[model samples]
Target chain A: MKLSEILSLLEGTLVSEHADWDLEIGKVAAADLMSDVLAFADPESVLVTGLVNPQVVITADMADIVGIIFVRGKVPPPETVAVAREERIPLIITSYTMFEACGRLYQAGLKAVDLES
Target chain B: MSKVSQVTRLQELVYELEIAEVMTRDFLSVTPQMTMREFKEFLQEHRFSGAPVMEDGELVGIISIEDLIEALAAGELGCLVEAKMTRDPVVLKANDLVVRSVDYFGRFGYGRFPVVDDQGAIVGVLTKGDITRGLLRKLEVEYHQEEIRRARVNHIFDDVSSDHTSISLRYDVEARNFERGGRASRSIKRALKRFGLPRQIVRRAAIATYEAEMNVVIHADDPGGVITAEIQPDQIVIEAIDMGPGIPDIDLAMQRGFSTAPDWIREMGFGAGMGLKNIDRCADRMELLSPHGTRTTLRIVIYMDER
Candidate 1:
């Protein structure tokens, strides 16, 4: 799924300048632990979470995540936003809670990696 | 004013003032006897700000979680304590004032200090945590000392903003020899994440940045050097240089047909006649400067649109 489609589907607000919303996103990992994401998640996935910190972006970049959806209408700090901008990470704001966001995206045709793998 | 008996001039109660007062006696310290891997495990077990090295009942040195963090940033392989430990561990005598300890720590940035007896035996240890408490306990000279302390940090990344740029704070240099590769690349990735660089851009930056580091390490031999990165709101620039082993042919090296990389580099999934090409593809601008013999300089740039 493309990030733009997800945003349009969820009616997500464009908090920052939107670029490359058409970037292809494969799987999604929802977590707050940066180390876990860096160590476990595959690159080219969308990251969904509410944890807002500079380190979160670092982990996401290291893991090669494609897009970051700030769930629950949470706004990230300036430092976090700064990192996103510098790294060219697309930051989207959505009112959907983490569970709902994940499910909606999944049902919307975004496939996640199997847990058994 | 001197003759008033109600205002008695009495001495304040102060402890014998040994670093031992804060040392964790139960906590095991890494001695020379342990392997480097064990020392890594030791760091993982305890969330210690730092630890003192003890050998046969005597203090030789000290290591901290920060040391390991810095070492891991460097990527040193093998017995690390031998390679990573700071030599001539600074000591705080039992009678030394807490002020002295603070000054020493503030200057040397020693995460922890060992309190020792006259017999050279470590009786206790002092950490930054202990020192922080010591500062708040005894009202410090707030104005001048505080300014002096913050000044030394020099905060190489101070002007950085997560508001528009990647804020990074990792270095992979030969500081203590614990580790010294992939640090610049790792930090760039972190900065990209914090700055919210888009996924494709972030990956391009990491690959481009890392290839530059790898080039310096493998080609820049015998000459000590560094790979420096700068993240402005508009772009990220990575420059790697070494004073040894200069490239003979820039044109051929840039070509996809020519490569001097060893078999090991290919085995590691690199040196497929692709380094320069990959970097060229990933970076906005690529520049190389070398005069033959040893030293080589590589520069890479990644731009972020203001939209």
Candidate 2:
């Protein structure tokens, strides 16, 4: 799924100024634990989480996770937002909870990290 | 003894010591008039492999035991030092870092270097052993200073903590404020990067922090949440606390694809229920507390050098 489509589906606000909204997200990993994200998330996956700390951006950068979507109407602090912008990782904030965010993306044909080919 | 301390000590040594402090000042020298046979006897008597060749207090060349052996093999023992010594040898300035001299040693595969001053006069001779001994002395002084600091800090704190140095950061997550999400995690990431933590550990810490922060923003009621991250030489610890609507069924919440968020929330692309599970997966150790909607607390720890 393109970042723009995911943004529209979740009614997300783009928190990172430099994110390529047109970037393709081939898979999705929805988690709040960064360790799981590091161990399991594939490069180019969109990280769907309700976790709003700066580590999310750092983890995405390390694991090569392409984007981040903060769910359940959560807003990350300015510092976290700045990290995403600096890292050039697309960040979106949605009103959906973790479950709904993952489900919506999954239903839209964004495969889970494990299920993706 | 710890890896953190070892790296810190190495950094201190590399940044602190200069070549002049380590070079030997009273080094033997050979002049061009000295015969190869006489220089060979001098090297054997002193158990030295090399010495600088000087003429009128200026470095003219360098003579090694190998040069004598080569001269002897070629029936040139009667030749003067000028015939055997290497002229215009590689040299180091006294003000240069000891680390730079070490680099020259590695690059040139030389046993010794002539230390020179601004006037092109040879001031001393530096061998690899000299540099190592100097660094050891510097390390001892650093350790002594560290011990005094630790003693003072312990007296003030009353409780002796682990030896590792640490830094702490706090970030606030506001509820239902989409515009400002991820600010805390972003800053935490920057701090970790500044600390030069391994890329893997930084990433795990960051992911766990984001998840914890999000939980407060999404599930907590009214007052929002706070995340405190403590970065240590060996590990990173993050704690997220929030005013509650705590999870009623912890077991169910830990499962994949289970959530209690409203349909609108799902429409916004969340509520697939992987928050706690993800945090659990990322943290080397995790503690979660929720006693029926009062407060929810989550702690995540990641070791910095697991590999």
Candidate that would win on DockQ: 2
Which regions of candidate 1 are displaced past 4 Å?
A1-117, B1-180
Q: Give the count of colliding residue pairs in each prediction.
A: 32, 46
Q: For residues B202-254, what per-residue lDDT tens digits would candidate 2 score against the true structure?
A: 77777777667656766778768888998765678899888787777778788
DockQ of each: 0.07, 0.12
Give the alpha carbon lDDT tens digit for every residue of B1-307 in model 1: 2534212311111232344544445656887666556777876677555677777777777776766677667775355575677778878786676656667877987667778778867777777676546444443444356556455323324643355544334354432121244557777676666555576677777877766665665555654468777776567788777776778888889886466767654443344455677678678888988875466788888887522
Off by over 4 Å in 2: A1-40, A44-63, A66-85, A90-117, B1-164
Model 2 error, position B30 (Å): 55
TM-score of each: 0.36, 0.43
